[model samples]
Target: MGSSSLRVYGGVAGNDRKAERRAQLIEAGLELLGTGDGEQGVTVRGVCKRSGLTARYFYESFADRDELAVAVFDHVVSGIATATLEAVDSAPAGTRAKVRAGLATIVRTVAEDPRRGRLLFSPALSSTVLAHRRVESTRMFARLLGGQVREHYGIGGSTALDLMTEFLVGGLAQALTSWLNGVLDLSEEGLVEHCLEMFLAVQGGRLEPGDGAAGLQAGTG
Candidate 1:
């Protein structure tokens, strides 16, 4: 019985060490991929060096650099989603307030960690794996936004709502990307205000048909 207990303890210790190494690798990937140098600096050797782990440990955790990049992207997006949801949930009862809270959380998060912003929004980091994960994350956020629309405006799930949510999600993405890349020239508060106004317009049905194109233009400008 003592031998069996020792074996189980040894197994747990090994698993914990492996988990720690995996986390280190993920952090290294985030540092390399999320920085200004972008994906070019995310080689396995670079990550291993940054992580202070050997290549063998990297291979144990990820199949390749693309996988690591995707993991880092997912991690960043997950944190953003969590913070937004928490802010929205904790806001006082009002659709506008909740929306502002959520949007503010997102803007503040990116502003706090510009590296995460670049990892998430930079066109330069759009490798196939990262791009695919981006689309997935966008769809998830759109669904959350759709829920908010339904709760706030009594909109049912229909083709039109689906299309509207997609447009809103895409517009938000472009707006954030431009803001992060310095094209928008907006302060953090200004960025949140712009996004909040657009969301409010959508809720009020105030946006004209051509407004979507105009919004994209403004965001890029």
Candidate 2:
């Protein structure tokens, strides 16, 4: 069928229908994978059952259970990362402002949808495909952070910046995991504030190519 004729079903296009089904499967995967049940929760049959779709529809979106799980993880991570970037872009200038803006967006995004939090850090992720994806995500965040830090510092290439970014990314991930697990003993606001401080503190350090953010302070973002 041509593209225009694909919209015959209640005015919804075939591609749109497929996208909806794909989203449904991903959301179902999120529910299963983010639960305390972990990796085992993301079977194809389980996803089909959870999404209230047939096996045929499930295969239409994902090649396998692992693919769906990976898609769910990527979706959540992409959501938070994209929101954080937008928040930072709209925020007022200054090191603290940018940091606070980004941090607050991340915390709020996951808080608004707790599933994203659990999906990213649930204990159920032990020694699974999700674990590997988590590591890869950390690297992506590190690159983003490192680039932003260098831009703020007006600095050039330096391995120390890379190291610092990795530390921040890994530390933040662990800290967020603790927070989500109820071991951090802090409210979402408190978590964001604390993390903002830490990020600014690190940004304040003197790297090889540029000076520290010596005069930055906590304020409106």
Candidate 3:
């Protein structure tokens, strides 16, 4: 079947069905990414097979594997971002508490499926793929952290916020990589607790022993 017969999601007549199918394909791609090694996670063929949809459907919504990968990346990032925001935004009572909540949400979500976590942060993906994703992911991180910092601590307007956001994202990315590789032996709760500790220390809310986040604020600010 051609792209015409394959249907475009959310575009026009018969679009709802196509949109639903597209959502399923993206979901299937994420699941495949979960089960496979981080290295082989979610190829186009794998997504088609897992989604039980025709390859034509894939091309109908995506120009190529890299395009499909970008779609999947966006979908997954949106989910994680939503959950993380919710976790952080709910009445945390203080800046430190909210920051801890935010860190907890991030580490727990990534720890749940490390392969997808790795894929989200992989810099080696195609430039076209990486460009679209970097913008989306960076914006998501920036929006959440910027809002939280301003609301909880009176920080404003993309100065320290940018540095802090980069620190949080880069730190979490490295932590996820280490955990997935078995170098970091931390349970979800332990991950959340330890990560929050370092995050707070680095955020300048505390100065304690073993806080790898020391000097992070000065460097970023």
Candidate 4:
């Protein structure tokens, strides 16, 4: 019984170590991928070096650098989504306040971590896997936006609502990318305020329907 228990404990320790190493590799990938040094920096050797692990350990967690990149991208996206949701939920009970809180969280998150912004927005850094993941993330956010529209306003599901949500998500992504790249020329506060205005307009029924403006107005108004 003692020998059996020892083996079980050893196995559990081994598994824990493996999980820790895997998490380390993923963090290294994020560091490399989010760098201004660009995609060229995101090599197996570079990630392993950044992770303080050898090449052999890299293979234990990932088949190749691309797999690691995809994993990092997913990790970053999940973090952003969680932050946004938490901000909105914690805000005072008002549509405008919730919108402001949610938008501010997203802007601040990317602003504080420019690498994260690059990972989400940089065309030069995109891979096939990352691109596919981006689309999936956008669709997921759109669905959430649709639900918010329904709840915040008395609107039901419709094609117009779907399109409006998609448009809002896409436009926000582009806006953030431009802001991150220094093309938008706005301070973080300015950016959040600007986005809030558009969101408020939508909620207030300023945009027209089927055309992408209509549903937002109905939902928010």
Candidate 5:
């Protein structure tokens, strides 16, 4: 809050340098948390080393490893959420169209960089700090889903909407985790199509079973 924090050195503002260092630290944290077994294996020294910064710089950015882990988690989640929201908003009106657009964004975003997926759902990274961040992201996504359904259906709040969003969010986390880990055995588009068809059968209009499966088989065959 003082001019000292705003002071410039070597043509770079102090605040700018601090932000760059913070970003570097967050990226370092992401690498550690995403690749390691869990937070137990992560250390401040490890992150500092990875970022090529010293302990003082690490302390300037994060209080501890836990805070860094949460920051890393949030960085990934915010990116995916922003891109998906843009895709969904730009898509044609209607639940199926909007959700399919959003689904493609989410799938492609993670598939392009699977470290993002592992950081989000891999059991290996489920430390207390990340677990809480995971819950927050889940609920946040649930709210987004619920808001979408409401917009598409022109309906008010309801318990059914809340339950459906929770179901969709949980199901997505599990399904995408499997896909990312190779357990789902579906290509990126196949996974997106499958989810678009199966995940919202509760809407109950034209989402017959095998809708996506038939398409997937044909595309693969």
Candidate 6:
């Protein structure tokens, strides 16, 4: 290779290293947030200490705590979104499989790491980060609905899509938050079944007797 090619390759490698370090810092911050009482949350100093990087490095990657919060929130949510999309994309060509695949990702991702799920679904961050957190999730649900609605339901419209997408995002958020708060008793499998049953009900479809219940598991002291 020419000297110019070598220089370009070297620069690319350095950039990747920098990006990896930045991601590490962000992940460290997220980890700290998951620890402790969660009242203080994760501060810039705390993150720098946890990351073993200087405050200067944290600034080099993020402007402030809120900015870092956004980055951490994005990092976590995007991982879940990617997994959900892949599950939905590869599901068998049927409404049942597709819906199960999408909702299953939600429940599994939350249950996979209860701490991370709490952080992601908690009101522990700024309002801005909280608001933007579900944008990707909502978009994923919309895409998931786009294919299934047309194929199995034989229904298609911007309005219907918007409603179903809202239902999925809002419902999942509420379900996870409730479970985190001890209001809902939902196992990984149970949550997936309940969510799909609720979706069908909201879409004006009836639940079969053996499928699942739209009601919450009762009694919490």
Among all candidates shown, the one with the greatest lDDT: 5
Q: Which model, 1 or 5, shows the larger TM-score?
A: 5
- What TM-score quantifies how close candidate 5 is to the native fold? 0.88
Estimated TM-score for each candidate: 0.83, 0.87, 0.74, 0.84, 0.88, 0.75
- Write down the worst ten-residue block by lDDT for model 4: 206-215
True-vs-predicted CA distance for residue 156, candidate 1, Å: 3.3
61-100: candidate 4 lDDT, tens digit per residue? 8998888888888888889889998888899977778889
Kindly give the stretch of ten consecutive residues in candidate 6 with the minimal lDDT sum.
Answer: 212-221
Candidate 5 lDDT tens digits, 122-178: 988877778889999999999998787666655566666677789888999999988
Better of 4 and 5 by lDDT: 5
Q: Which lDDT tens digits does candidate 3 get at residues 91-182?
A: 45766677677777777777677656756755444356556776668777876776666555543454555777778766876787677667
Task: Give the top-scoring candidate (TM-score).
Answer: 5
Off by over 4 Å in 1: 1-12, 152-155, 205-221
**Candidate 2 wrong stretches, greater than 4 Å:** 1-7, 205-221
Q: How many backbone clashes does candidate 3 have?
A: 0
What is candidate 6's lDDT per residue for 32-129, written digit by digit as tens?
66655553667888888888888887887888877787777677777877787789889997667777998898778877777667666666643656
2 or 4, greater by TM-score = 2
Tell me model 2's lDDT, rounded to 2 decimals. Answer: 0.81
Error of 2 at 110 (Å): 2.1
Task: Give the per-residue lDDT of model 1 (tens digit) for 79-112.
Answer: 9998998899899977678889999998899889
RMSD of each: 6.9, 5.3, 6.4, 5.0, 7.5, 7.9
- Which prediction has more favorable TM-score, 4 or 5? 5
Q: How many backbone clashes does candidate 2 have?
A: 0
Ordered by TM-score, highest first, the candidates read: 5, 2, 4, 1, 6, 3
Tell me the TM-score of model 2. Answer: 0.87
